[model samples]
Target: MSRLALPTVIALALALSACATSNPDVIGRHEAQRMSQVLDATVLSSRPVVVEGNQSGVGAVAGGVVGAISGGSVGGRREGQVAGVLGAVAGAVIGNAIERSTTRESAVEILLQLRNGERRSVVQAQGSEQFAPGEAVILVTTGGKTRVMRAPPVTAAPPAPAASH
Candidate 1:
C-alpha cells in the first residue's frame, strides 16, 4: 500500500469519529431506560415554569481531539507534542464556550408532590422538547440526578375534610 494512502485512511477515520450523532456516550437505550425513573415526579404547582441551562459533553470531547490534532500538526515532533497539549486546552475552552452558546440546557423548576403528600419545588434536568411547564410530566430521580420524563398527568388527590369545632 502507498504511504499516502495509509495516512489518508487514518485521517478520514478520525474525522468520521468526530462527527456528532444521537449516540451521546454511545450507551444507546440503556441510559434512556434508566432515565425513565425520573419521569415519575409528582406535580405540586398547578402551573409549571420553564428554565434553560446547558448540557455539555460532546463539545468538550470533540474540542479536545481537534485541539490535540491541530497542536500535533505544528512544527516538528517535539513542538507538535507541545502544540497538541496547548491545542487541547484551547480547544476544550472554545468547545465548551461554543456548546454553551449553541445548546439549550434542559433544566427547569417545577412544583411536585410525592406519594406521601409532601409538596416541594425542585429543579430537574430534561431533554429538549421533552419537558414543558403546564404540560403534565413525570419526575424520575436516579444516581443522584433528577430528570423530567414525558408522562401522563397524575390525577389530583381529593381535598382534605374541613375541621369542625
Candidate 2:
C-alpha cells in the first residue's frame, strides 16, 4: 500500500466504528443532565432480535477515494483513468456492504405491561442488562427516545419522627 493509503484506511476504519448505537447502556452527550420520564412496567416477553444496519454513505465515499487513488497508479494515463473509475465503483459497493454488516447489532424485542394496564413493545440493542418474562423493568424516556432497564428493588420508606410537644 502507498504511504497515503494506509492512513486513509485507518481513518476509514475509525469512522465506521463510530457509527451510532441504540444500546440502552449508551447515553448521548446531549442527553446528559436532561430530565426523563420514567414508567414502571413488567416484561411480558423478551426475545432476541437483530437490529438493521445503517447506510450513511461515509463508507462509500471513503472507499471511492481509496479506490481511485489506488487505481490511478496503474499503467498509462488513459488506462489509469479507466481503472480508477472502475475501482471506485467496485469500492463503493464493497464499502456499502461493509458498513451494513459492521453496523448491524444484536438486539432484543421486549413486550411490557405498565402498571396502568397499557402494553408497549420496544426494540433495543443488547447491552449489559438482560430481560425475561415477568421481570420488573423501567422504561425511561428522554428526548423522544426510550430505553428499558431492570428496575431497582423496592424498599420501604423510613418512618417519620414524632413532633416535639
Candidate 3:
C-alpha cells in the first residue's frame, strides 16, 4: 500500500488537472475570430444557472489501471490478472465521474426578445457580466454558440482618415 501511494496520488492529480482548464463556452482556436452575430435584444428574464461539467472518460481508465495493479498484487499470478481486470473497470468508472464533477461550471440563463419579434433563451457562464430582466443586452453568437454581454456604449465613430491633400 505504501509503495502505491505516490503513483496513486500522481494519477489522481493528473486526472484532476485535466478538469481545471475546462470552459463551458470557450470558442475554439480554429474558429473565425470575433466573427460574431450581434443581436439587439431585451432581457425578458435572467437567472443564475449552473453548467454541468464535462466528462472525457479519463478518470475511469486511470482508476481501472490503478485498481488493477493494486488488486492484482494482492494474490497469486492468476488472481493478479483477475484483479487487474476488475481494477481497470473500477478505475474507468471513478475517473470519468471525477472528471465530470470537478469540471462543472457556473452560468446564467438569459431570456431575450430579439428586435425582430423573436424569443430566445441562452445560458452562458457568468464570467464578467450579469443580466437583469427588462435590461437591454447584446447577444454575440459565433460558430453556433452565443454569449450574453453588455451592449457596447453608443459612440460616434472616429472620423475617417482625412483625404490626402
Candidate 4:
C-alpha cells in the first residue's frame, strides 16, 4: 500500500477504536438512568435581615454637629453628650432605611433537601410560594438548567501543548 493510503487507513482505525471504547457502564442520568425517586425533602427559608446604614460624608458630619449642639443646650455639657449619641443613633436608622428603600430585596432562595442529603436551591420571586424543602422534584444534572441529560464524561487524552508564539 502507498504511504499516504496507510496513514489514512490508520487514522480511520484510530477513530473507530475511540468510538468503540466509550464506557458502557456510564449512562445518561436523566433519560436512561431514571430518577431514583426523592425519598424526603426540606424547604429553605430566608432570614429577615436589617440593612446596614450608609452615612454620606457631608450629611454624617453635619448631622453629628447639629445633634451635638442641640443635645448640649438642654442639659449643659453632659446633656449635650447624651443628645449627640441619641442623634447619631437616629441618623443611622434613618440612613439605613433610606438605603433599603432605594435598593429592594431580591427574590428569596428555595432549597430542596433530598432524602439522599443532596441539596439544590432555586431563586423565586419574593413572597412567592416555593417548593417545600422535602418536595420531590426530579434532580437531573445537565449541561444547563432544564436540559435533561448530562454530557458523557470526557475520556479523550489531554490536548497537546500549543507551539510557542
**Residue lDDT tens for model 2, 34-68:** 99999999999999999888788877776777777
Query: What C-alpha lDDT do the candidate models reach, one value each?
Result: 0.55, 0.86, 0.72, 0.42
Candidate 4 or 1, higher TM-score: 1
The TM-score between candidate 4 and the true structure equals 0.24
By the lDDT metric, which is better: model 3 or model 4?
A: 3
lDDT of 2: 0.86
Best candidate per TM-score, number? 2
lDDT of 4 at 88: 61
lDDT by residue (tens digit), candidate 4, 37-85: 3223445433333333233333334334444444445566777678768
State the TM-score for model 2.
Answer: 0.89
> 2 or 4, which is superior by lDDT?
2
Best by lDDT: 2
The candidate, 3 or 4, that scores higher on TM-score is 3
Give TM per candidate: 0.39, 0.89, 0.76, 0.24
lDDT at 40, model 1: 47
- Clashes (backbone N, CA, C under 3 Å), per candidate, total 13, 0, 10, 7
Worst 10 residues of 3 by lDDT: 18-27
